[model samples]
Target chain A: MELLRPDSAEAAAAALGNGSVALAGGTELVPLLRDGIVRAEKLVELRDVVPRGVDGTRIGAGTTLAELEVDPDIPQALREACSLAASPQLRSMSTLGGNLLQATRCWYWRLNFPCYLHGGDTCHAKAGQHREHAIFGNERCASAHPSDPAAALLALGARLRTTSREFSLVDLYRLPTDEERNVTALEPGEVILELDVPRPEASVYLKAMERRKWSFAIVGVAAARFADSIRLGLAGVAPIPWALSSVADLEQATPLLGTAYKVQIARALVRRAVEAVSAPAGA
Target chain B: MVVELTINGNAYELEAPVGRTLAEVLRLDLGLTGTKIACGEGHCGACTVQLDGVPVLSCITLVHTVGDREVTTIEGLREHPLVEAFVEADATQCGFCTPGQIVTASALLAANASPSDDEIRHAMAGNLCRCGTYPKIERAIHTVAGDGGGS
Candidate 1:
């Protein structure tokens, strides 16, 4: 087993025989190492498979979230979300691909006390203090997924590039099931070459964050414009970014700008996530 | 891991342990010395540096992973106009955050040639000064906008 940062998807695919794990930004991975949750005998670096500058920005799987934040042409809302993902230090090291596939942060999982999230027989967040877990599209594990930009990407109708698969972020966002392989569609060999987003006319990402700098989003919004319509995604509110794509009235998009129902979804999601995980430490 | 990287304009090949920070590599190993290490963690931008033209926290960034990337430290900014302006405005009281401040300020000006006072404040928010010389730093940055080239 050798650590390999392949230059292409084909190379990564060939290297991932069976037990191989995809390594992106090590921000999350390093933490897992500290906690003794997972380990890789062989590492795969995705530096070579970077996206080229073209008509639209093709953010390579390895592109740090900070790099995208500085591009002048990127949508301001998305940029703001990326900027606020964590501290400047973390932003410097973390990548978008890694953010999407991070492990759960539930207290249950953190203490090494096992539940269904790690393939056990029960889910503690279901009837526990699950308030912070999520209200929309939650499952056995009420762990809110880690990516801050995912919500914005879904609303912007971004296209994800992979070695064997490709799709708009919306179609890819079906509710996860027990049979699901991973949170993302990425195979062992596949790499997120770039995320292609069309120009967004109006967008915003409002966040509920702890006073401490490196904390996760307490609750956040990744709302973007459509054809005279609007789609809102709630982050830090669910296991995945909850996209409210069925807003029928296009005119009522920004009710009171920062203080409206569109924004309320993020708050609502937070309340639910907190409810699910509110159990007293153990089962 | 044995990694080869360039700092400012000098090329260096050094053995950096896993979890050994780039900030450590720059200050301890090769002795460039100008880049100070105030906070070992990433909170204080005192250890900030530009990696491939973008400002990043050097403390948390691993040394081995850099792999030939160009790193610009405060030692590299000796003659940069931003440094001169900071000196002209006397933006140094304790002088601890000057390196990080100048490096961060240079990045800001490069991206936005004419930023508003609020924009400048926001850009430098990550880089903190213990003595609160922010007013002087702001004035120094503003000095770059006008046509006057005097100190």
Candidate 2:
């Protein structure tokens, strides 16, 4: 295993040319390594390389998710989510970009059961005990978007600032599939330098997991405002952080159960994301 | 490659292989045995240590991830007043979780000198004492934090 530590974001991406690269944070990649879920000949350390700016709350791909929440500028909802996560110790190690890019922690997937997520033909959780899975995009693959910070970012209309390119939240991540490879729209050579939420946006992240600590979500919620429009995103409840139009729009939208708005929005978005996919099992 | 880290006022310039976890570096290589290793995973904070003034798990924390940061182990806190409170309270029944417990408690005190019971519980929740000495642990934390000092 080789350790790659570039001096700058440009250097990092420039180094990532057309090869098997492992983007790491203590949160996602380390656990996968220990679990024997992933093997990498080239291990890149991203924490120190990316520049962190105070004015815009710049976060490097290597910075832990726990560090982001205590940033004082981060929203209260995000702080609560971070505090409620695995623990302060875990938070001290979990990075924001890594959490956002983490693969789904579904039991079937982690257990190496060869489900749809791993390129198998069948999706076990879709028809099985999927209450903990996506509540919305459940037509095929039934895994939840495991990133809690993703929900917060989605609500705030956060964007990814890649080393050589840039894309909005909706653009960067791969479209989710209930039956095939689920990925954020990250290309092979691209390195995530920093994630950006505009200075004007206010956002919050919430998740109802099984335990007090170290558990994934059963139902997650994030609400934020962008260009004066509030968007609500759900995690542990859909394929992506289930995005919806402003709550005011929903109130003005075809009136139904107020409690059922999240579920309905999740169902709608999940269908759209799955419908937009073109790959077979794993692309 | 060779990486130098300042752990608990002692400078360790060691060779860390690619993807070497911090837990392995501390207990296995450094001979600083105060930091315990229960779960190799991030959960179950038996490997908690103070890094750059914040409490973090050593198991998942890679040696390469944190560069040139100051690390405070449980052994370093031996002369601390909090440890005295812990001993007075008899907080450790099995003694396995004490190192992590002391590291976490020191971090909590450093951040907030007079944390409430809820705050103490919240900070210590990550460090699980399977021996179930929570009551005395809570009392010890309160005592060292100068709240109750366990009567």
Please give the lDDT score at residue B126 for candidate 1: 73
Model 1 lDDT at residue A264: 64
**How would the docking of model 2 be graded?**
medium
Where does model 1 exceed 4 Å of error? Answer: A1-3, A17-27, A30-38, A57-67, A70-80, A87-95, A102-133, A137-139, A170-182, A196-204, A208-216, A247-283, B17-20, B31-46, B78-99, B128-151
TM-score for every candidate vs. truth?
0.71, 0.83
Q: Whose lDDT is greatest here? A: 2
lDDT of 2 by residue, B15-134 (tens): 988678788999889888889899778777888888887888888888876677799998888898878887899998989888888888888888889988778877787888899998
Instruction: Report the lDDT of model 2 for residue B4.
Output: 85
Q: Stretches of candidate 2 above 4 Å error?
A: A17-24, A57-64, A127-131, A175-180, A199-203, A225-228, A246-283, B149-151
lDDT of each: 0.67, 0.69
Candidate 1 positional error at A172, Å: 5.1
Per-residue CA lDDT of model 2 for A1-283, tens digit only, reads: 7878877666676676443355555566777877767766777666667655334555555566566666787665566566666677766666666677777767787777788777787767765545566545555566777767777667667778886687877665554465437567777667776776664345555566666665776666666544445566666655566566643333332211222444554445434433322133453
Which candidate wins on DockQ? 2
Error of 1 at A14 (Å): 2.3
